[model samples]
Target: MRTTKLPTIELSLVTLRSIQKKDFKDFFEFGKDKETTEFLTWGPFKTLKDAKTMLKYIYFKRQQRNEPIGYAIVSKETSKMIGTIEYHTFNHKGNSCEIGYVLHKDYWKKGIMTEALQKVTQIGFEVLDLDKLVIKHLRENIGSKKVILKNGYKLVAIYEKQHFHTKTGQYHDVFVYEHWKK
Candidate 1:
């Protein structure tokens, strides 16, 4: 049975913690940024209500299932939610999971995501004992490609016309990366 629980991971520049209702304001701050959600499956949250609804779904519903271990990425200095990351699409029988993340555009290229991802990948392998972890991004998202590579993930596959961009309303190729426990 799956027994791993998402824990509050503290790092030098960021902390990955469970989402809170009180984070509504900060959540909306970045969730509404077009540039930040450009490559993400979900947002560009149109209203505060939308953000609240999403938080509820993320914190309550997803948690109850013990899947999609979600985290709110907070800046240590500002104590504000700057992004989110998660280990989702779990397959217990296969001991595998997919990693997903998004950061505020302002924090891009700062190595913040690299640090957060390294911590979460360690958690997936050492704590959860997962055998394989996968990460995928649009073929055009170079930033995501860098982050995946920096974490020692290898390009395992590419699916053509596999991902649909909500905003652009166009299908794009996706690159899948994976890391196996050594």
Candidate 2:
């Protein structure tokens, strides 16, 4: 096994760095928003304690693992956490990983996520030396589809009933996208 570290990534509008305890408030802000957590697997935090517990788990994983699994997406101007992006899954043997992210609803469709995704994918390929990167979004998440396509990820597959939606209490199809290092 190879150990890797998450490098701080700076972009024109945002900075991607390790999540910190100080970011709990911002984390809660987005995590508690139903619209923000709509397409995500977990969230819509019921209370500050819920947010704190989740943040603690993230930090705990970082402490125990050899590399970071997630990052806080901070706005450069306000220095506030507006989102999170992460390589949630890794396959060392295949040199590949699956990436995921979420942004505050207020920041949606503003190109912030597009910029962040571009930078993070670059990190996955250039910094982490990954041969391939994958991302999946609910079929209804057109915004995510656009971001994925804009970043040059190709639609590889659509799995039926691939995800269980907590809010809807039903299964939904998922669109899988992929980018291969050239």
TM-score of each: 0.93, 0.92
Best by TM-score: 1
Cα lDDT for residue 34, candidate 2: 92
Q: Total clashing residue pairs per candidate? A: 0, 0
Colliding residue pairs in candidate 1 = none
What lDDT is reached at residue 24 by model 2? 86
Clashes of 2: 0
Best by lDDT: 1
Per-residue alpha-carbon lDDT of candidate 1 for residues 79-100, written as tens digits (9 for 90 to 100): 9999988888888788998999
Model 2 accuracy (lDDT, Cα): 0.86
Model 1 residue runs over 4 Å out of place are none
